[model samples]
Target: MGAAEHRQSPVGVRGAVAARSVAVHIAVLVDEVAFLLRPRDAGWVIDGTVGMGGHAEQLLEGSRDDVRLLGLDVDPAALAQAAERLRPFGDRVTLARANFRDVRTTAARHGIEHAQSVLLDLGVSSWQLEGSGRGFSFQLDESLDMRLDPSLPETAAGLANRLSESDLARILAEYGEERFARRIARAIVRRRPLGTTSELVAVVRSAVPRAAWPRRLHVATRTFQALRMAVNDEPGALRQALPEAAELLAPGGRLGVIAFHSGEDRIVKQTFRSLDPRRFAAVEPSPLTPGDDEVRENPRARSARLRVLERLP
Candidate 1:
């Protein structure tokens, strides 16, 4: 859990490493979140998407001894990792296996009246994409079951194999904003019953012409991202969690959200704008992104955008 876990200057990571480009990356914006939330000034902190407790651990270590944190996540596997990581902090840290959307009720049940800071790092984590063999990444040829929460009924395979061509296209276009959504959806329907990540990847590759493939992104990247979002209902959950976390903030508390892509960023930006400006101030005119060093060290963080919304008295 030393530098290998993570090491940054402003945020807190360790070791020297070469960053490589990948189809998907975990963009936590740890430095910006740690800086803007001002953990030293916080009493109770909440990490709604506390995947592996990276940010939670950083906040606790950076904060005063009295500061406590409540960490929540939909993924049980992630919660297990977090539990082990945060064990050293004892009762100062609380871990819950729950979705960020239910943060309001979950926080209340935990006897937390309000939080001094709340954080939500949207989309899949490094563990899910790389470690978890649940087929989140194209690199893994595992089953197309991308369920963050085990209890979730549906799987990415279900959507890819069951949804109509048009419906599937809509999800790709809207959720992933892929230009070749229609072609991909059509290819998927024709090759229905795609049981594995490799199968789905092949179908996508066949659908998009080699000439039209993105330079940096994999041919199947958008399709997988869209299917995962549809299966998990990410957009819907995000819409609910933003306001809930915002309202759960104390008078001076700030809610920090790190969106990895444009679609998720749009929701975060629009939702922050919809809040009462008099009551909540989005101090950052534009979202803060990972610095050159952070991106150079961890290329996965290149697309991260951190937006802070502070509750006013």
Candidate 2:
């Protein structure tokens, strides 16, 4: 366990106060994920993006004692939180700091030959947005460092400061799906060397027309998303991990993915379909969305879409 894990809330006055002040991240689509994964009596499970071990905890609690879990994550802080959260499970749980793109290799290093179930919950975590000063949230005015793994060479600020206008426009248009990509890129280039989240937010707000500003979404949302994606190479990672995950699944094993955006959903859908039909089958023709009650309680889950596929025996 890391330092953060050791500092997790305990049964004390200060712990109680800290717990009350901090927001708990609710695991999205828990029931749906459990239903799709359907943990076997005695098998290994892999949680590719085990943020705080929410889904992993549920799976372990809901499964037989013989079942084991291999949880992987890019962020060391998240792994620390997960280590503390999953400590009760004892030796049944294994935690590793790694990107999901290297899931197969990481699992192999840990002596996991194959997985009976695999889960990839792709998107930003509440902890990252609320606590980490990584600038994942546009509402918070922090440094423009959006790398999930701090070791990553690129930062959002570096991209904003260095990339040419056309390249930046391409990233916004392709990754963020921003309509005013060129305008925003031009404005960002003109400003050059944006240091903080507030600075970037101001640039975005200024670049877009007042009438064009979205009512529900902040103007800076797209640009931040684009930069984060570029810095992390999220799409590329997903593309590589999908095939590796599919190959790592035991016969009749299931792969469930919860994607929070259109780009991710599209990639999952296309990749699953492109898999050998004789070896794989879609569990559902369409994606499952969070119910109204869940969305009302956890607004962050509103955009979640879950899809599952099974390996043929």
Candidate 3:
């Protein structure tokens, strides 16, 4: 079991300590999200992927005392930290261990049928990348288990070691958008039973030519991202969640999505554009990105794209 699960209470002292240590994991584009959502006018707010409660805490602080929020996440570790971080809000804050794809039913079960604003920060949190020990980062030497939800049956190790070269290549190419997907898949196939992040990283390094490596990003970044997305079925989850969120939006309600990968952004773009123009409107011609200063402080925010949709009153 993970360290966070061992604690008796998520809002207890130990979880509080863990929350404090991860203060560096900034929630990307907080100001922009707050501006679009307008917490002051909100009655029910749902942060569909409330990692570490950064956005949730800010919304509570910025809104009226009665404005309640229902926070959902697949990551138990993140939810625990969020519970600790949002403890001061008392009963106004309600959290559930759930995937964003299940937002419609989860919200109903919690007695929230519709919300004035919903925010889905689809990027995996910095805490998950740096500290979760879940093999989300290639820089980490942890085991090759990238399942964000422990209940997930497949692991990165299972996909890498078990799949055929053609199948693995397709996953790399489609999910990660890796140019050297076939080469990487071939390398992985030759090196079977890979069990650690380092092992997979080594195989990727050997597959791509030295000169072909990306100058700005790590050689294994895309590979790790693709594996994580595949193991978690991120694309499928996003497709399911976006429509459900739109359905639960009240008139004049705003739904915001933060996407880090091109594939993720594409899905968001298409879904938002496909909404009925008479009822729902794309708030902007394009997605909003982090300001230069925000990106400077957190390099991970460099690729973040936020798209918003609002129901017409």
Candidate number with greatest lDDT: 2
lDDT per residue for candidate 2 within 1-313, as digits (tens), equals 2211211122242223223321333598876676567464577999999998888988888788988999999999999999999999999999999999999999999988888889999978888988998998899999999999999988999988999999999999999999999999999999988999999999999999999998878888888888999999999999999999999988878888999879989999999999999999887788888766677788889999988887877
Q: How accurate is candidate 2 locally (lDDT)?
A: 0.86
Identify the runs in model 3 with alpha carbons over 4 angstroms from their true place: 1-25
65-182: candidate 3 lDDT, tens digit per residue:
8789999999888899999999999999999999999999999999888788899998888778889898999888999999999899889999898889999999999999999999
Candidate 2 off by > 4 Å: 1-25
Q: What is the lDDT of residue 110 in candidate 3?
A: 94
Compose the digit string of candidate 1's lDDT tens values, residues 1-313. Answer: 2211121322322111123322322335665566677455537899999888888887887777888999999888899989998999999999898989899999999999888889998858777998899899998899999898879998999888888999999999998899999999999999989899999999989999999999988888888888888888888999999999999987777888988879999999999999998889875778888767678778778888888887876
lDDT of each: 0.82, 0.86, 0.85
Ranking, lDDT, top scorer first:
2, 3, 1
lDDT of model 2 at residue 54?
A: 89
Ranking by TM-score: 2, 3, 1
167: Cα error in model 3, Å: 1.3
TM-score of each model, in listed order: 0.90, 0.91, 0.91
Lowest-scoring 10 consecutive residues by lDDT in candidate 1? 9-18
Residue 53 alpha-carbon offset, candidate 2, angstroms: 0.8
